[model samples]
Target chain A: MNAAPGVVAVALVTLATLLIGTWGLRFSRTTSDFFVASRTVRPTLNASAIGGEYLSAASFLGVAGLVLAFGADMLWYPVGWTAGYLALLVLVAAPLRRSGAYTLPDFAEARLGSRGVRAVCSLMVVAVGWLYLLPQFQGAGITLRSTTGAPTWVGPVIVGAVVLANVTSGGMRSITFVQAFQYWLKLTALLVPAVVLLSVWAGDGQPHPVGGDGWSMPLAAGGGQGLYLTYSLIVATFLGTMGLPHVVVRFYTNPDGRAARRTTLVVLALLGLFYLLPPVYGALGRVYAPELAASGRSDALVLELPRIMVDGLAGEVLTGLVTAGAFAAFLSTSSGLSIAVAGVLGQDLIGRVPAGRRLGGVAAFRLGAVLAVIVPCTVALAAPNLGVARAVGLAFAMAASTFCPLLVLGIWWRRLTGPGAVAGMLAGGVCCSVAIGWTLLTPDPSGWADTLMAQPAAWTVPLALVAMIGVSLLTPARVPGGAGRFLARLHAPETLDLDRG
Target chain B: MNTPDPGNPRERVRVTGPPRRRTPSAVRPPIDTETRLGGMYLRSLLREQLRLAAGVLLALAVLVGSLPLVFHLAPGLSSAQVLGLPLPWLLLGVLVYPLLLGLGWVFVRRAERNERDFADLVRGADR
Candidate 1:
């Protein structure tokens, strides 16, 4: 095949991920181990894995793209994505770990004492999982179609295959190892090229930032739309980080509440350090690849920047490395989402089966893997025109609206009854879902509602919280009796017994 | 006093004190005593978690809520240019994330410290 260097790089990365997953399978044994590595993952390793999985196609490629388009304003995506973890750490992570549940649905059932709430959580998990998955598939499609003259469907198919293979092989135990490895790969890919490109730009007489006739000022160029977009982004990134299923599931891998909190701290540091680089790439892109700024395809900003600046064999090598890293982002994130969605769906829906059915469990999980990967792939392919970064932002918004509020109320308030939980979820879910649905369906959609629909987290989160509080307070008698005790389990220090299992 | 009889491993486990209490009748195993005490201990722990979670969430809510206000207040930012973007835009847009990271880090560190302290207490009591 006459593949672009990117195609070859992506292929090699996929192969590596497969090999690693196969290797990870050797350590797997029981169901608990599959879901959460038997809850014994230490802080350092867990943090590395979280970083790996967390740095999705958005982080790898979208950051530079946002920067290229919006200039300094785009810096918020990386910052918010990173900092969202703080919310997770303080409000949900340690307690979530303490809940001893394998998935979000599990947490919901335990906390709210309602099968109904778990069911609502189950549906949202799949929706958010699919929304998050859409970008990974889209990024893959972009990578493939850009690099090779193949059909766009090829991108989603290839990523879907790799994700299915890895997720089916080892689940969380396997994914953790693979993600840790990919984090380093992503770092190296971006770091090495960044250093070389800076030197190249420096040697070529160091062009001034803001390039030629383009507006370099943040909203000066973007105008009113800019402020709207920026704050919208902040809301999405900050809150959306809390609701992401893949990221949340990682907390379950910690040995106990304390370990989970430590893991979050490490995640914050790793993310902060990683985020420092993307802005440099964007700033550099401004000077090196001016056309990306002029045209609106800054999403392709990072890929094109190196080639625009570098030349000959060196450019090819650098492009190849970046391509691999981009592929790593797609694989790690898709795999993480696929596993999380699959786990939740498989357990809550499928596991309630005839007893002693080992084959049934594995098969159900595998089927869920396919479902998780395919839905996003289809959605991404269907909506071929979205900016990858913007699409990913939508996913964050929906998550923030739905999961962020659910978790916050569920964990902290003893009086959050099942009916109240359902009401809040329905209100938040309907509004956000309608907004997302409208945004997706309406081509040529524009203006404030469009912006709000496109980024509903800011409004929807508060709406949900209010609804949850209002409904809960009105019918306080239905609150679960063990809410107090269960809350304690989530907050208490871990004993070695909890760690051992 | 209460200690674990270990007669029933699944449900009944000793939580505090020695095994028996002096009574008029033959002494009953302190199983009920430990279970009740354990229940109370567990409730307190949950209360602490709720307290910590609310504290962190409220703080984040404030930080996130203030972005538009803070950006409006910043000097020399032209509503025009700050950080290569609008002051309000950057605050609402890009600033929220690093703020997220900062807030997330603070919450997680404090939470972990809380958990760590709780764990130490548990370990200490065991000893």
Candidate 2:
């Protein structure tokens, strides 16, 4: 009864991984299976797997906490995340598969016919992947430290080790199964406690969460800064969805364009369903655990609420359930990203040089998995907290800037030369990197520029797209043959997979 | 590395202009109009791709550019009572996602349709 939810969540995650990993063990064998489950994953199953991996620690803990502190505006984070897949489904998914590539770099090289483009794509994938992974470890540390009073590093270390174990064991194949199971586990974890807490809150007179300063609206609300911040969030969520490397890579696991579309639809529904519950927790946190808001770190809303709202055994069990789901959030996302990063590393870095022959296939993936997990885990601890959802928002901005324009131009515009693609990535990367560097390093900036720069995605995606299209127009001669054809494929995925007129 | 299909070589692109020269693929084989599709069909494919690409680009631009406009245009709307719920609740809580979902679905379908049409054109050429 005394054991905290954080401790229980970790245990549940371990059990779920062992069970699902075994279930997937039978299906995984060849390198192809390891990489993409042989591309036969069904829409429904893949949808759940997508949900499992995509619903990160931010979704589980940070978002609800954000809502508790920042009102309904914070809801956009999850909504955008869910909708981003829809963009992927429509724009990139089927064509990506039809391109018949293993990674984003593979697709870039295939489209533009340039190794240099591939190298840049690879580098961006690693960068975005690392940025995205940082929150998972940070959340883990927060969960563990808050629940059990353990050393903060314990959370990230355990998260990294568990993620490494799952990813190295079977690549995407094993991780897919692991993720799908965790999705349900996470849903139940959050929902069950929520239902109980709501019942408890209602029992205690159903008052709204109070304690202002931390829980109410922003200080500069209705001002230029507020307006700019909101719109910037919209842009990042809207465009950034298309560019996340791990998420985009998942579409390749489907059998065809039709399957990819179907998978996206299912993902939208599943994600929408899952997203409905967390904000309720945040709203409830206002009533039950307003102290968290005043003290800062409202991100620990889930961990803190159960004890204040419910005491003794009931609270402990509920906390454990939340912890398990929280752990699932960390594990599924980290594993998915790790697999993507490892695939890129294996094919581009290790495969090209042949030095990694000493570590083959799963072994290589295992070693790569460590890179995928540990670096971010260490960073999560050493670096100052970005606040889970806000940090994730930054990652989205980067993805939108660099990958979103690259994919759109590469897929649709025949005039996109190798030079244009290179130029676009460089411009987007530079702007985004500077913005992020400024945000983290300075944390304070001049008026309009600071607002514009803090939320770079709003303008950066456009800047990159404009640069790409402008440069592309100048060098129509560089447009590759079949550019039209390639675009047709990207837009019309199901047609290729079907035997219709 | 997997060796590319070897059959493409013998046929190479012949530039239609005065150069009238053979276009070569640095490695595998030069891309040629290997199919029997007439010039008219190739022209049609090019036209259709242009139309679709333009539409997709316009849609993305409009979506990205209009954020400031949407909030600014809403009359005396405070942060509350947007479509029954408040603006923040409505936008972030619900409508934005569905809007995004609709747009994303459109993008995927359009992209897929474009792909299928191309594949068909190429297949028809092959036929």
Candidate 3:
């Protein structure tokens, strides 16, 4: 593939993102605007922004790659990711927005009335944010290397710089416009090429995917272990969406609890529509580009497919379009995450410090943005290539184990005490982190151990829930006196004239 | 016991007026103060919402969650064809997206209804 088009596509996406961010910055004058867009974003716009930010490199490129490489079971990744929002809608959406939290840590503080829990939550947010970010950075590296012949480091550096620029310039308000633009850009980039490619396939002859029974079946031949892995993945993704700091923060941008629920519903539809295209690319890749899987470069299957199937300017254009989408995926997701992490860091870590207190809210946030991007970019450049989808899966597992329990229990369980929240978070966070570290640092081929370590959500989530409930029961006296009032606020409709204090 | 303390000169004027009714203002809904009735209202809302959420998740579990086990138990399903593609391919890939969207829509509609009903009940009581 000629590098010129790919280079131009990347440049265009970067320029568009920066321009949109700057445009949004003009309206972002207050601290509230920087954090939650002054709680004025409508459902459709917020949903689009959420979709843009939520569909990271994992969804954009990794899903196609995994589908190309693995058989039918890999389809669960996309399904689980989309279904996550369903879980979010049914459970966490309205109450979380009503909590009036600027970030996950803020939610913890509001619910538990404990600075200790808030501090712990802030740490978890940064950890999950960075874990999720590593893959986006890594995916960017892979994308740039394939498209523009750049070194792996170049991609992360450029993406990190772009994210920092966008986040610092406009904060949440600016990134909302930038990310909403990205959703449509990404959709067009994938959809147009997919339609054209499908027609091309039909024109030639719609050949069936060449695979054995396992490729077509959900879990053919692989027995108990495969079932465990699949279930673990489902648990992680279904429960974890609510826990993702960037995703949850988007809800706070909605005008109220009702809009938040509406936004989530729209997100589900948007994600469902977007997810349909990746599998098409994946299935087509299986038929047209099997060598990609064999060569261990299936992650590039989406970018490489158009060029391989067609041989002309049109093919180059399709490649350019997909590349632009992939780049936009990285930019939008990274900007959202950086804003989320920076909000926490600015308020909890920096603002609490003597020198940091002297800096204004925006300045502290700008510094936090720089700190947030640099660490992940550096780590991504240093870390060996973990498959993009798998790394993201680990992050989901971490979130499911940690924040899922906190959010669910804290919102619904009035008896939940601060001690219980702290204990649950620590237990879940520690166990998941250990499991992730073991899985990443040491590759164990042992059967059950490997599976359990690789997909820890099944056990970790239960442990977290049990710890929270049990601890809360034991420490009944420690439950906050304002629990009833908080529950009233969380459960009541915004239309009701409640004090909510 | 009836005599007021001389050190505290403020009048204890509780003589003859009928006890004032504690009518909470509309601006400050009773739920905020967790009155017995208000607490009941909040709990009822929470219960209804939780049930709705549970119902959605159960449907998800039964419909989507059991597929892997079903396929694993009966491997022959893999060979079945639909639209010239294998059954698993169609079920997992193309069809599941719409199913998910439908599930989400159903949940949202029902949940919002529950909230609206709760709001109406509360407002009716306030009136």
Candidate 4:
């Protein structure tokens, strides 16, 4: 395969990203722009940005791969991911935006008036960010390796550098533009290839995959374990999206609560449209590249399929297009995550310190960006691959288990106290981390125990919620005096003339 | 007697009724959310939004969530073919997206409407 097209495509994408980042830099003058783009982004642009940032390596490359490897049952991944926005839209979007916080920890602090809860939330944000970033780095590594025969380390290093540059220089303002552009790029890349591939398949008589009954049916072989895994996945993705640090931070960019809601509604549509293409790739991969699945290189199915299915210049060009898309996927998501993590780190840990306070907001945030990108990039290089989609799913599960309860209860329940929020977060975070450890350490999981541990969201979310509710009820006196005021601010229309403070 | 005392400030009594006090421009509670009435408004808005959210989620649960169980139980449905593909393939892969988009549209519309209604009520009460 000619590597010229793939290499050139990647170079162009990186250049475009940097140019756009610099362009957006003109608008980013203040700390507000650095953190939340001055909270003035319109619904359509914000929605596109959210879609871009949200669709990481998992949606671009991992979903099709999982579908190829696991067959019909894997469709739930995309479904749950899209529906997760629905969950966000109806439950959290408007209130969170109305909370008038730049970050999740900020919301927690404002809501509970407890630095302790804020500290816990900050830590959770960093944890989730790293967990999410790890897969993106790994996915980039594989994408570059598959496309240009580059060493795996080269990919993570390149991605980390670009993300760090984009994030540190322009912050959220530039990232919004870069991400919005990437969403369309990703959509076109997948859509065009899918159309061509489908036509090719039709010309060849639309031969069905040979996997037969097991591939077509859900839980045909795995039975009870499969059912449990599927349901747990649903619960995680549906709830987890609201809690993702990168995703939640985007809501703060909206002009108001209503725009936030509208942004999310548009996000649902964009994601649904983008998601419709991946299953097409998956189904096509099944028909053309079954050997890739058999060989355990399913993640590369998206990158390799175009070249394999078509011949000559067209094939190489298609390969280049997807490689660019995948690279954009890595860059956009990593940039968003880095900004999110860096924002929290800058505000809570770095900027609060005397030394960092001297460095000031933008400088501290730049340093935080460095700190955020380095750890994950290094770990991704040294650690073994954990299958991009699965690692992402784990991140979702963790988010679902921990922050999901905190956000939901904090927004809706007036009786929620600081101690209750802290306890609930710790309960969910610790248990979910245990499950994550078990799943990662055990090479071969078996039986009900492994199944439960493997996908812990189904149980851990409820555990966290219960702990919060019970503890809050027990410590009713601990509820903040301003709970009613805060709840009013969160739930009320921004147009209404009330003192949100 | 009224016309006779033109000199020496002739008992000029201004009938103003002690500075009529402007009706206080509709005295009402400060709509501060910390107040009980404000809290009640908040609670009502929350309850309405929560109910809307719950309805959407339940509909989603019934429509999409039950698919796995339905497939697991029926098996025949999974095997059934639609346009040269298995039923599960078409439904899970192609159809569910529109369903999700539709549900999202409905939820956004209703949630916004609820907010609009709440705003009207609050303004009405203020008046």
Best by DockQ: 3
State the lDDT of candidate 4 residue by residue for A1-501, as single tens digits: 578877998999999999999999998899889999999899999999999999999999999999899988999999999999999988899999999998999999999999999999999999999999999999998999899988889899989989988898899998999999999999998989889999999999988876878886877877888999999999999999999999999999998988998898899889989998887888788888999999999999999999999999999999999999999999999999999999999888888886623668988899899999999999998999999999999999999988999999999888999999999999999999999999988999999999999999999999999999999999999999988878888887876766655
Name the best candidate (by lDDT). 4
- Model 2 achieves a DockQ score of 0.17
In candidate 2 the C-alpha lDDT for residue A353 amounts to: 68
Computed on C-alphas against the true complex, the DockQ of each candidate is 0.24, 0.17, 0.48, 0.39
lDDT of 4: 0.91
Residue B6, model 4, lDDT: 60
Tell me which of candidates 2 and 3 scores higher on DockQ.
3
Q: What's the CA error at residue A365 for candidate 2, in Å?
A: 3.3
Pick the winner on DockQ between candidates 1 and 2.
1
lDDT tens per residue, model 4, B42-112: 78988999999999999999999999999878878988988987889888888888998899889889988
Per candidate, native contacts kept equal: 0.39, 0.29, 0.78, 0.73
Docking level of model 4:
acceptable
RMSD to true structure for each model, in Å: 6.2, 8.0, 7.0, 7.6
lDDT value, residue A214 of candidate 2:
30
Better of 1 and 4 by DockQ: 4
TM-score comparison, 1 vs 4, better candidate? 4
Ranking of models by DockQ: 3, 4, 1, 2
* TM-score between predicted and true chain B, model 1: 0.54
Give me the TM-scores for chain A across all models, comma-separated: 0.94, 0.94, 0.98, 0.99
Chain A TM-score for candidate 2 is 0.94
lDDT of 2 by residue, A72-144 (tens): 5576678667756756665566557767787889889888887888999999999999999998888888888
